[model samples]
Target: MRSVASRFAPYQELAEHLLQATISEPMDAAHDVGHLLRVWGNAERLMAEEGGDRSVLTAATLLHDCVHVPKDSPLRLSASSMAAEKAGRVLDSLNWTAGDVEKVRHAIEAHSFSAGIVPTTLEAKILQDADRLDAIGHIGIARCFHVSGQMNRPICDLFDPGADRRALDDRAFAMDHFQTKLLTLTGSFQTATGRRLARVRHDKVRDFLNGLLEEVLPDAMTVSH
Candidate 1:
């Protein structure tokens, strides 16, 4: 309902900068502009319902992936960090305050599951949950498989034999994303509203995983979507 500019001019300016920078990247699957917008949309809804700060949430959403590279690629991760620094500079150019920029930048950097950056603020948690939510359900499945293709990782039933159960490895981020970020998001949400949404969305992915696992046993490939 209410637009961003009428609320906080500084954050809205930073968000616009983030938009231009992220859109310039060579993103295809998980990090695309459409996907980022979806996460921000979800964050907006949850933040409004939960009474969190909308401007900060929006800033986190836009900047979170401005430098996000694939989890397994160390080179990309380094590149991502450099890009994040550049994003900070971009924000600085907009005259955003040091405190607000630090807050936004920390949330952006900590939003990654593999990075092990835990959320300490409601804005951070909202951003984390929104990003995590995108990694599940129908869209999430497609993104996961798409990511697997990018990583050249083998496809495996996430519920069993092929899914690596090890903890927090970036190479396993594609399919195992369900476990690392998606599933964990169920509890990590800062607000009750987020937990509710996360639980429902989380169930969709879990059910999807179970159905896929059942099909993987044998003679089930003929089942249609």
Candidate 2:
């Protein structure tokens, strides 16, 4: 796989400047600069194979989380829409062509899981899949716990880590996020490469979950001793 830096070589300077100016101060760790870079890297990898308007995808990735909403806020679902509106102004300030700016805005608006808008363009789909990829696997695990901590949620449910017998409430327990969102991302990917990569990452999540379960429920490992 080519280095993500190489993929963003053309847009690196602009992306960095825009990010510095737009990303919220005291950002949520789950959606920090590191998260933006990972999402861009994922977009590059998927775009390399899937093919799309690289400029639009790149801009969308960098600006997707420009508007950060608290995890527990009722407006959480509207973050993407808010980001899209803000991104338009930012792109215009940079003198991006109006047409290109609209494309970027559309991609950003549709990228959110809560937005419920199907990506109508290849660039939009790649942006959506790339962002979602960051929410699974090893990086996803780190982000899950990071957000959980930010929201004052426990790392796991001491009694039902997998939510087998209770309602799935990711807001209350980080582990419930796997079943609530992460595990389901593979099938939600738009591009074939996204799906392939998501499957590999998805397995990593399964491994983590299994390990956690075995540690928490040692009797599940017993053989009638």
Candidate 3:
């Protein structure tokens, strides 16, 4: 708990208390403690510029994935709301005020794209932006492949890698996800800071996809051509 608290300054005590009280077991490589740290780091960066409730954002980030659903699960859409509900119960057990708990709960639920929630609160917006930041950059690239491997999905369709003839299906090929979701995340960011950061990561994804195509394509482009 101290180590976890150390990463979240100014809210070290709150982080420690929540860390001790929360009963979250590790879910997957993509949503592990490292993922939490990355999202919290992003929230801190966003808050530095956007201005939000530090306590609310901190609590939301810590307990956001307390309930985990697999990326391939049919229940993926409900994962965020489920997490939010469970987080509310956890906060209630810890004697948190109902208003603050609701704020945290809303942030957790609205952070998910699958949840289709429009973030109404500043904290919810911040959490959504912060969480999305982790889904696009080099870290996002690593996590994408990691989850792909876990799901037993191929990196891409070698013969028709760009999905020119068919609709994008991320569930079938990992690379299709770039077109279906990852590349589109920049526009969906709720905060200006998140959008700014997302552009840089977004470029990295494009570069990576280009490189991947160069390697896998049958008639790879040549320098002279």
lDDT of each: 0.65, 0.82, 0.86
- Superposed model 1: Cα runs more than 4 Å off: 1-15, 75-84, 157-181, 218-225
Q: What RMSD does model 1 have?
A: 5.3
TM-score of 2: 0.90
Residue 33 displacement (Å), model 3: 0.4
Residue range 123-169, candidate 2, lDDT tens digits: 99999999989998899999888888877898777886766678988
Q: Give the per-residue lDDT of model 1 (tens digit) for 8-49.
A: 344665566567777676677677866877787778777677
In order of TM-score, best first, we have 3, 2, 1
Prediction RMSDs, each to the true structure? 5.3, 4.1, 3.0
TM-score leader = 3
Q: Tens digits of per-residue lDDT for model 3 on 1-225?
A: 688788988888888877654445556888877888999999989999999999888899988888878887899999999889988988898799999999999999999999889999999999999998899979888999999999899998877888876788999999888888988888988888888998999888888877777788856432210
TM-score of candidate 3 against the unseen true structure: 0.93
Pairs with steric clashes in candidate 3: none
Q: What's the number of clashes in each of the models?
A: 0, 0, 0
